[model samples]
Target: MREISLDRLRTLVAIADLGSFAEAARALNLAPPTVSLHIADLEARVGGALLSRSRGRITPTAVGETLVERARRLLVDAQQALDDVQRQVQGLAGRVRVGASTGVIAQLLPQALERLGQRHPGIDVQVAVLTSQETLLQLAAGTLDIGLIALPQLPVKGLDIHPWRRDPVMAFLPARWEPPAVVTPAWLADQPLILNDSSTRLSRLTAEWFASDGQQPTPRIQLNYNDAIKSLVAAGYGATLLPHEASTPLPDARISMHALAPPLWRQLGIVHRAGDSARATAHVLDVLWEQGVE
Candidate 1:
């Protein structure tokens, strides 16, 4: 026996309500023969007559009555399911798992999320703090839906990546020191540099920037957190290089920001699985694009 067709079930309901094959056909936008065919198919499948025709009146058999009632409930459920998925596609609801660096999570994501919450409240964003390389790894492992990572990275296979923004690398020095308006890599190399530690892409980029000038500036101290590095810099521990957004110079004006000569920019970008179709993920990416790197 075959599964009962929804069309046939609907035709059964229409026929029973209209009390005539011709009338049901007209209501269903089908021919009288088509309506009769639907009833015949249904009766054969259920091994019973579904309608009794008497003097132009069509009364439904017990089987027809029971199935038509169930069909109405099923149709309602099916429509509800459709509506739910449609909302999901519109980016109104879903969950997005994100992985990003500390700098982005601290300075950028909070601002983006503020607007995101106002605009897409149904979309829940979950974040995990990770470095650029770790984010890429998680994206590949399918543990992350999207990633905010440093650009010019070694390409990860099967990932869709694009540059989002480039923030100028700035040097934060102690308040007492009056550095030049435009600091050069050579000049920065000579200072008691506080590097961002080798665990981060920033560390490699800064090191390469110094190396490009045929200079190897050794860091007086290495710290991972930007706040900690700034605290140390404020106390005259050493100067630090960071993306402009990462520098928090307020509350204690002990650090000053200076532009870099031949200004180096820390390129940041968003990455996701190729052909990602998650609506929440796309919505977040769109928000990031519209929001830019604030």
Candidate 2:
């Protein structure tokens, strides 16, 4: 047997409410013949007479009452589901999955999210800590909605990348060391350094900076977490190179920060799928861009 359509269900519900085929047709903006055909088709499919004429008034039979009750709930649920989708399309409410480096997440993303929450309280941003390379991979794989990645990266197909921020990479030294006002690559290279792991783009950037001065001294240790690197630097383990976001607080009193003599900068970019973005994702992208320099 063919299944009954929502239109027939609606016609039944309307007739049960209005108690006349002509009244239901008028209310539904359907012709009288269409209304009669709908009831006939629905009864044929369900194998039951759905209406009764009693004392010149039309009313539902037992089967019709049960079907109408269930149909009402289904119609209400379907309408609600459409409304939720419309809200997401309007950027009024939805979840956005975003990927970024731990450093950026720690320093930059919080402020951006805070502002986003204020402007769009209904939007929930889900943040993931990922490397620049990992972030690009996630965005390409359709697992992520947005990415904040290190710059100077090779292009990835099917992704759109936009330069977002350029913050000077600074040398973080133990305060007790009495370092120079501006740290040259040679000066930092000669010290015991806590550096990002060789696999990271920042590590490559820092390594290139050192090589420009013909210096490539080995680090005391390599680590991927920036906050952990800072903690080690504070313990007087060694000095390190890291980007210092303008809005972030300076390191603890035990650590001192100085600009690179040659002015090395850690560039960052925003990435997303290369097409029209979902409204919620677009709203998040706007908030992230607001945190960076124009």
Q: After superposition, how far is residue 74 of candidate 1 from its true place, in Å?
A: 16
Tell me the tens digit of each residue's lDDT in model 2 across 97-209. 99998899999999999999898999989989899889999889999999999887889999999999999899999999977777898788889999999778899999999
lDDT of 2 at 30: 100
**Candidates' C-alpha lDDT:** 0.84, 0.91
- Per-residue lDDT, model 1, residue 47, is 86
lDDT of 1 by residue, 49-115 (tens): 8888788699987887888888788877878888878888888888889999777888788878877
**Pairs in clash, predicted candidate 1:** none
> What is the TM-score (0 to 1) of candidate 1?
0.68
